[model samples]
Target: MDSPSLDPAWTQRQRPPRLERRLGFADYPQVQNFLERLERLCERRQRYPDLGFGRTYVNLTIYPDQDATNVGDAEEDFARDIDGLLN
Candidate 1:
């Protein structure tokens, strides 16, 4: 599938998608939802999880995890950082 030339509202200034969409759609919301869940269990830091222009599908685990350890000791900070990128 092809992506829109315009930027997606969920992510900041994204370029034209070069990755292939696995599910025949951008699936932006799906990926964003996963990121949201992940954000709930991480330290305060900058997140740059680029699932690649809708090229991938999210497979979330039913557990809490803090994978990114680059900020303080709160997931809120990381969430906010990722939130900024998402918007």
Candidate 2:
């Protein structure tokens, strides 16, 4: 059977979203340990957390699990050291 038609707008693929947040760390050991833990978890979890590392900073992005509205929950749950990073 022929499929029902979707709205023209719906048929178009969305642009790759430019969604992200930058969090900095001054204490290298703490941040490295935190990212390592997160990397381990991502190996077992499906949320697919990504960290974009800089000389002294990191950018966070998660896919297929959250959007802008509830991104904080992921940060809180994944990045426990987030509080330290913020200070």
In the range 1-87, model 2's lDDT, one tens digit per residue, is 743332221111224432345656676775686677656666665455566875566676543343454433443444433333344
Give me the displacement of residue 12 in model 2, in angstroms. 20
Q: Model 2 reaches what TM-score against the true structure?
A: 0.46
Q: Evaluate all candidate structures by whole-model CA lDDT and list the values in order.
A: 0.36, 0.49
Runs with alpha carbons beyond 4 Å of true place in candidate 2: 1-14, 65-87
Instruction: Tell me the tens digit of each residue's lDDT in model 1 across 1-87.
Output: 642233222222223312111222256776766556556533333333334334345421111134532322232333344334444
Which candidate should be chosen as best, given lDDT against the real structure? 2
**lDDT, candidate 2, at 45:** 52
Q: Cα miss at 6, model 1 (Å)? A: 40
Q: What is the TM-score of each candidate against the true structure?
A: 0.24, 0.46
Q: Which ten residues in a row have the lowest lDDT in candidate 2?
A: 5-14
